[model samples]
Target: MSEGFGAKVPADVERPDRVLAGLTARQVAILAATAATVYGQWWVIGRVVPLIVFAVLAGPLVVAGIALAVGRRDGVAVFDLARAALAFRMRARRLHTRPPGTGPAAPGWARERAHYSRYPCGRTGQLRLPPHAITDTPHHPAPLACLDLGTSGVAVIAAASTVNFSMRTDTEQYALIGCFARLLHAQTGPVQILIRTHQIDLRPALAELADSLGRLPHPTLRAAATAHHRWLSELATDTTLLTHQVLLVLREPTHLHTTQPGFTGAVGSGRRVAAVTRLAQRLDDARRTLAGAEITLTPLSPEQAHAVLATCADPTRDPTHGWTHSWEHTP
Candidate 1:
C-alpha cells in the first residue's frame, strides 16, 4: 500500500463525512427532524399544558434527539442500534423447518379462542421459515460446489489451508504479505474470506486405532499403540480441542458475461455456463495466487457446500465436522 498510496492512507473511507458542527449528514438530519417534531408538538400541546409540564414532556424528546445525534455504541450510531433492536424484537424467535404448504394451524374446535398473544404452536411448534434455504430447483450447469443465489449472483466456495505466519522470518513474512496483497489486488469481483472455528472431533481417529489393533505384527507394538490411544482418549476427555476452517468465497454475477439481461435473470444454460466459467477462472487464479503464500485451495463438492450452509443456518442442530446430508448418496 505504501508503494501505491504513499506512507499513509485513511482506513475509514466508508465513514460518513462531518458536514456541520462535528455532525455527519445523518446526525444533522436526525437532529433537525427531532427539532421540527418537538416544535410541532409544542404548537399542539404547549398551550393546553403548564410551562413546567410542557418542559417535562419535551425534555425527553430533546435528550433522545441529542443522544441519537451524538451517541455511538461499539462504533455504531445509536439510531442504527435502535432500529436494529426494533427489527430483532419484531422477527420470529422460533423457526420451524418443514416442506412447503405444510404449516400447521389451530384445530376447528379451538379456532375462536386460539388467536391471541402468542404462546407456542400447539402442533408444529414454530412459525414459518423466512425463505427457502437453498433452491436447487434452479437449474445450475456448474457441477462444482457453487450456489445459484438467484438475481444476487452465483457463489463458489473453496476450503483454504492456513500458513504458519508467526513461525516465518521477517523476510519470509514480507514476501507472504506481498503475495497476499497481490491476491487482493488481482480480484476483479467480490472475494470473501470466511473463518469458522469448531470443536475438533476424534471419533474417526479412535475408530481407526481400534481397527488397527488386531493387525499389529507384535504384542509389544500392539500394546504400545493401545496405551497411546488410551492416553489420547483421556486427553480428549479432559481438554476441549478446537480446529478452524478457512474458506475463500468467489462470486460471479449472472449478468457479467451474458448479452441478454433477461437471460441473466432466468439463469439460462448460456448464463449458467458463463457464470461457471468466470467462477472457475477466478477460483483457479486465487488458488495460484494463494499458493505463493503457502496456502492451498480445495474446491468443495456441492454436497459439502450445502452442508456448510445448513450448519451455518442452524449450528446447534448439527456438528460441524463430518457433516452428512440426506442428499448425499448412501455409498
Candidate 2:
C-alpha cells in the first residue's frame, strides 16, 4: 500500500491465513522490523535497568515520572485522536467492504505462543525460530467469500438494459422483434418488465405567477390572467408542438474514460478534487456529444430543470422537434 488512504483499508481483516498468504516481502520485512524493535526495547529496559539507575543516580526522578506518564497516557491519547480524525474523514467516502464476516484478531495475538514456534535443525543442534504460519493445513478452513450476509441473506444488484423500438430500420426491427418474441416464448425464468412515466409539474410556477398577479390592482390582475390564458390557447392551436423525447445514456462504468486529460500529470498529488474535475469535464463532453446528435439533454438538478421547463408552453419558442415542429397540440 502506498501510504495515504491505504492504511484505512486493511489488506487482511482478521483472516490470518490470508495475512500469511498475502503479505508482500516488504510487508513481512516491516512486520519483522517492528517486532524486533518492540522486543529489543523491552530487553534493554529489562536487563539494563540497574546500569541506567547507576548512570543517572543523581538525575531528577520528576522528569522520569513525567516521561513515563506521557509515554503511557499522552502517547495513547495522541494515537486515539489520530484514529478518530481518520475515521471522521472516511465516513462519507465509498469504500469496498471486505467479504462478509471478517474482523480483526483478538488482543495480544502476536504475543501468543500459537503465533510462533521454534524448530530444531536436522543436520545440527542449532535452533531456528519462525513466526507461526496461518495455514489451512490442520487448524483453519477456507475463508468465506465476501457476500452480503444481512438478515435478508445475500443480495446482488443488476440493471436491465432498455430497448428502443422506434429508431431501427424496418427490416432490422422486424427481425429483432421476431427474435425477442421467440426468446420470450422459450424462456423459463420469472421475468418482469417495468415501465415508468414521469410527469412534469407546472403548478408551483403557475401559483407563483398567479400570486404576483394577485398583488396588482383587481382589474389589472383579471386582465393579465385573461391575456395569459388567451396566449396559451393561441399557442396550443396555432403552433406545431412535438414532444422532445430525451434518452439519457448514463455510460456508467462501461463507457467512462479511464484516463483523464491531465490525470497523468496530477496523479502524484492525490487530490480527489482533480479526479472529480476530470469526471465533470468528461460528463460534459459526453452530454455535448449526445446533444450534437439531437438528443435533448437534461441536468440532474431538479430546481434548474423546473426553471427551464417553466417556459414549456410559451408562445414564441417550441422546444419540441429542436425548433422545428410539424404537429401542434389541439385543445
Candidate 3:
C-alpha cells in the first residue's frame, strides 16, 4: 500500500514495535561473532591444555552459551541472515530506511521523513539519492534497473509492453520475426536483454472500480460481474491462476552521430520530437517483430528511462534518444 526507500508494503498497517525490533538485529550479529570467537578460541586452546585447563575453558564456554540463549530471546535470532541481506543491499545500492509513525506520508522522501521517529531507515542512515540529485535523463531506466556496459557498450532497461502472439496473423508474425532479427543486428554492440516478470494483482484496481460501479444508478455491469465470478468459481474449484507482467530491457553501445553544431540555435524543438518519434517508431516496429518471436518489448517509463541513461550516460554531450543503442566512448 505504501512505498518507502525502495521498499514496498503490501498493506497500509504499521507496527512501530516491529521496526524497533530490528534495532536488536545488530545484537544477533554481535552475539554470533562473540560466540564464535570465544568458543572457538577456547576449543583450540583446550585441545592442548590439561584436564584442569580444559575445565577452566568450559566455564567460559558455558557463560558464552548462556549469553547466546539470552541473545536469541532478546531478538538476535535472525541476526546472521538479516545482517547478510543488509550487507548485500548496501553493495547493490538498493538499501533504504523508514522512520516510525502511523499516518500516511509522502511517497518517498516525505514518507521516509514520516517514519523517522519509528526506525532509522536507509542504509547508513542516509537516503540513496538526494532529492535534488535525482535528474531526468534521455532514456529513463527504472529506479531498480541497473546497466553495465563493457564490451557490449550500451544497455537500456525499462519496463516494456507485451503482446500475445496468439492474436497476430501469420504474415504479421513472420514479419515480426524478421523485424526482431533486424532489431537484434541493429544493436551497435553486444546487447544484454533482461525481462522482469511480475504478477498483476488487479484486486485493488477492481475493488476501486467496484466502488464506482456501486454508485451507478444501474447495477447491470456489477451484477453481471458477480454472476460471472460466481459461475467461474463454481466451475473451477480451488483453481489459482498467475498473471504475468513483463518488463523489457535492451542494453547496447552508446553512439553519437553527426548533428548541427552550436547550442540553442541548432535543432528546433519540433525536429527533436520528430527525431525521437522516428526512432521510437523504428524501435516499435522492431518490437512488433520481436513480439512475433515471443519476445516482449517494454520501454522504460519516463523516470525509469532517465535513470538507466543516467547510470551509463556521459555528461559531456547530450545523447540523442537513438544513442541508447549505440556505443559511446568511456573515459
Candidate 4:
C-alpha cells in the first residue's frame, strides 16, 4: 500500500498549529464552549439540519467573541471601543450642506445657521435668536461704576502667597489654622478667597536663555545650550509647571450718612473722603494681619485687577504679569 493512502495521518493534521495561534489555552477553551453552546441550542431546537447552515447562523457570534477576547488581551474593553466608534461616527456626520436656493457663497448668518443645525442640540436659526450684542455675556464684571468705591461697596483685591502647610509639623499646622481663623474673625465685612492655578508659560524664560546663549563665545557652550533648549522646549509642552495665585476680596461697609447735620442733604466730598479713609484703614489692617501670619500680600492695581478678572473669565487668554503700579485711590 502507498504510505499516503494507508499510513495514519500526522498528529499536526488532527491538531493544526495554526488553529488558534495567538489565543491562550483558556481563550481557546472559552471560544470552544461558546461555539458548542450555540450549536447545541440550535440542534435541540431541531431548526438547523446541516452543519453549514448552523455555521452561517453562528459565525457572527463566534467572530464577535473572538474579537472581544483579543481586545481584552490588548487591554481594550469592548465598551470603550464601542464608545470610540460612536464618537467617530458622530464627528464624521457633523458637516453641513447648504440649502438649494442659497448661493454657492452663502451669507454669514446662513452659514452660522447651517453649522449649528448639524448638531442635535443646536438652535434653529440665527434670525430667530437675539442679536449678538444683546446675547453675548460679559466675560468680567463691568468696570466698577465709580472705579473707587462703587455703588455696591468699597472693595479691595489683594494677592497673597502662603507657606506650605502640608510640609509643616502637626503643631505648626494647627497654629497656622488657628491664626487664619482669627484673621477671618477679625474681618468686619464679607471676605472672599479665590485661588487660581494656571499652567506656567515658559516662553519668556526660553527667550532669555536663547539671548544668553547667543552671547556665549565657545562652540562647546553653544552645543550645550542647543541641547538645553531642546529639553526645555519639550518640557514646556508638558502641563507640569503650575503657578498658584490667591486673591482676597474684602468689602467694607458703606457709610451713607455723615456726622454733619447738613449731611441730611446730598453727601459731600468730605463724606466720600471719610469712607475712602475707612476702606484704606481696613485694607491696612488686613495686610498687617496676613503679614503677621507669614503671608506676603500684594494689592492689585485697577488695571491688574481687570486683567486678572478677564484671565479667569476666559482661560484662553494670557494674564498680565509683574504689575508694579499701585492704586492711589480705589481699584
Better of 3 and 4 by lDDT: 4
For candidate 3, write residues 294-317 as lDDT tens digits.
666665543544534443444333
RMSD to native for every prediction?
6.6, 27.3, 18.2, 22.7
Top-TM-score candidate index: 1
Model 2 Cα lDDT, one tens digit per residue, 67-181: 3323335434333455587877655332222322343544686436534647421121212111111111111122111111111121111122345656776665565556545
Q: How close is candidate 3 to the true structure, as a TM-score?
A: 0.33
Clashing pairs in 4: none
lDDT by residue for model 1 (1-331), tens: 1334334657666788989998899899999999998999899999999989989999999999999988988888798899999877777664555444565764876865565627753443343321112222224334456565545566778899989887887778788889999999999888899999766668779989989999999999999999989988987889977778999888777554433222224536576667767878888888899888889998877566766765666555454343333222211
Query: Model 2 shows how many backbone clashes?
Result: 1
Model 3: lDDT of residue 55: 68
Q: What is the C-alpha lDDT of each candidate?
A: 0.72, 0.36, 0.46, 0.59
TM-score of each: 0.68, 0.22, 0.33, 0.45
Q: Residue 128 deviation, candidate 3, in Å? A: 12
Give residue 6's error in model 2 in angstroms: 50
Sort all candidates by lDDT, best to worst. Answer: 1, 4, 3, 2
User: What C-alpha lDDT does candidate 4 achieve relative to the native structure?
Assistant: 0.59
Clashing pairs in 1: none
Best by lDDT: 1
